[model samples]
Target: MERELSRTLPHEPIRWLKEAGFGRVRLPREKGGDGASLPQLFELLAELAEADSNLPQALRAHFAFVEDRLNAPDGPERDRWFERFLDGELVGSGWTEIGGVKLGQVNTRVTPQADGWSLNGEKFYSTGSLFADWIDVYAERSDSGGPVIALVNVAQPGVERDDDWDGFGQRTTGSAPRVLLMRGSSRRTSMTLPSASATKLRSISMCCWRRWRGSAARCCETSARA
Candidate 1:
């Protein structure tokens, strides 16, 4: 599959996967997913990685976002995001920064205006942003300088996806840096997910991390047995 993917550069594997309902593998059965358990999801991911490593890496953020939404308290926000996922809209992330040692701390600024807010900053290692319908950017609130995650529409103004990834390999994963300049009214652009007191968020992160490590270990054990 990796060789096939390499031969088919610029192919739409994400779309193919989504069309096949791979995106909803972990979503609850009530929410139109297969209700796959964490171990099941990770095992599927590992298998996909064994076939084509870039496929799983490119879709990592999407899976993480799905997990976060699944773990979120039942509310309007959760419903809205889940509905979007069910609607076949892909969500990508742009959180890391250039020359930044700290993880999850972004230099992107989300400033408020009378109409809405403006997002201004550049992000590096923005994996899977280009192919996604929505981009979740980690930014600092201009008013309080607090960290926040803003969901921005990819088609909105001030968003640019550059194809300047100079990496020697995995070039088709769309992991290049990108820039976003979003300006809209509060109603349009205020979909911020607060992380200040994200106990649930932290729990979800740790859970996924453990599942990932366990999946790798299980794969190794299986290989040894084989």
Candidate 2:
């Protein structure tokens, strides 16, 4: 898998984004994807992480948000975002906050506008937002009511970005904090499970199993005939 990814990734972001098939790993088959399930998706993530942790972390974030966008119940909006994501035109997700809160808690607020919406808040641990064209910024429930998942186009005038990521590990992830200065159209929604930690555990276990089986296979393949 590492060899495959190294051959495919090319050490270039734009090329890898289009070639890796990472952005849509869990997308339904009907939507121009392989339609991987949770376990199978984990397998792929493990393989990719074994090659490069940052690679898989970014991939996991991308796909998790992709799944969220696809399932968000906003049919036209979902299709719009998903198509852009698949085409590598728009990268997605804003997974963290500057205040160190856990995922799913939002300090951001989305206000409805005459056209779409306005977003205001700071996000931390945004793994892919540095190069992302859009972000799924979560916010507190609006005073008007309904859900609070807002898909904000970061290229807009009010979006602000700060790539302040200098972590010891996963340096290549490009994780950072971004502040949304304006609101946008939003809806109540659930987030798909992140595959980072799970992918790590699965990679370790699979490596052990492969080593054990490899030893056995070697024994069988190089045995002396009686």
Candidate 3:
């Protein structure tokens, strides 16, 4: 499938994947999804990667965001976000910056104002942002310098996306630099990960690694049987 589509540089496979209900594979059955287990999701991802490496890599943020939403406590926020996902909205990530800083540290600033808040930051390697309906940006709160994630509309004013990625390969992923500027007031919504502690984060990372390993093993077994 990827070989056939390789000739078209701007072709977005995600649209087809979403239409096939691949994006909602991890959501609960009650939430209009297949309720795929972690291993199942990773196995499907591995298969997709085997077909087109760039597709899986570009959609990594989207998969992670879906998992986050699924793990979120039952509330209006989770329900609303899940509904958006079911509606076929794609989300990209802008968590990493160009600087060689630590993983969790963010230089972007989000300041509260009289009317709302302001966001100012520059991000690099913003994978999938150009193709996404919404971009999740990670920044620091101006008052306390705490980490916060904000979901911003792709067409929001003062948001700039540059398709200047110079990589010799996977150029179709649209991994480029993005700038978000809020001169004075901008309506922004912010959220923090439930397990934001360093220890918890590390544990979660290990869990994900294990799940992927298990998925790979299962795939190998299935291939052997075939």
Candidate 4:
């Protein structure tokens, strides 16, 4: 138990979370999820982090996507995504980009293609992406120049991920990896999700709570094991 944090990713634990439907904890019970509230989700995350901080970190993006979908207007389109979550598919983050003025403001971009929009960008510190079925990429449309979230399938040839972290601690928080999406077709979420909604703000708060609580939880766990 005292060994250095495994250089290997916690594939088995992540698999357990998926099979147990932890990823869909935010969905309604009728929608085949636990239907947990945001506060409840944050509570569970703190507990999960207590056991293994990396677990909550790995799931950050997945939960965020769940919340996003929960906020979307209900329809068959939304139901399909709910079913995907019920089926244990996970979403990963692709929000952060390196360099400056790669575009007007955002580095990532989605350009129109004959088939659909192609997401082209390089993201750093792409936490949890390696374990994801899809990536929730933040990109701007080239034509309209508006921001959108591009839900990109991981199986496509255009997505690339590698663990390139050289930091001093937490070798495998499922973080600090790089993801490159090169002209990958995506399912776009328009910017209509209200940013000011007090309910939706819980998602952002949950992210903050995970970061602040995860380390202390891990420390306590290590001490208990000692």
Best by TM-score: 4
Better of 1 and 4 by TM-score: 4
In candidate 1, which residue pairs get closer than 3 Å at backbone N, Cα or C atoms, i.e. clash?
115-185, 116-185, 116-186, 158-181
Q: Which residue runs does candidate 3 get wrong by more than 4 Å? A: 1-10, 99-105, 177-184, 188-190, 193-226
Question: Can you write out model 3's per-residue Cα lDDT over 91-210, one digit (the tens) per residue?
Answer: 887877666778667788778787666777778777777677777777788998877777776666777777766555465666765433334445644445335653254357457855
Error of model 1, residue 145, in angstroms: 1.1
Error of 1 at 13 (Å): 1.3
Candidate 4, 52-99: lDDT as tens digits = 767887887787777777877789868988999999999888777866
Over all chains combined, what TM-score does candidate 4 have?
A: 0.81
How close is every model to the real structure, measured as TM-score? 0.81, 0.63, 0.78, 0.81
Q: How accurate is candidate 3 locally (lDDT)?
A: 0.71
Return the TM-score for candidate 1, rounded to 2 decimals. Answer: 0.81
Error of 3 at 86 (Å): 0.5
Give the alpha-carbon lDDT of every model.
0.72, 0.56, 0.71, 0.73
**Candidate 1 residue-wise lDDT, 55-118, digit = tens:** 7767777877787778768998888887777777887777777665575566778887866787
The best candidate in terms of lDDT: 4
Residue 122, candidate 2: C-alpha displacement in angstroms:
1.2
Lowest summed lDDT window (length 10), candidate 4: 189-198
RMSD of each: 3.4, 8.7, 4.1, 4.0
Per-residue lDDT over 1-226 for candidate 2, one digit per residue giving the tens place of the 0 to 100 score? 4434333322375357566666666677887766887668666656655456566555544565555455566587667666775676545455355676665466666565566555667776666665566676555545654335556666676677775554454555546444334433433222223235543553454464456446645755687442
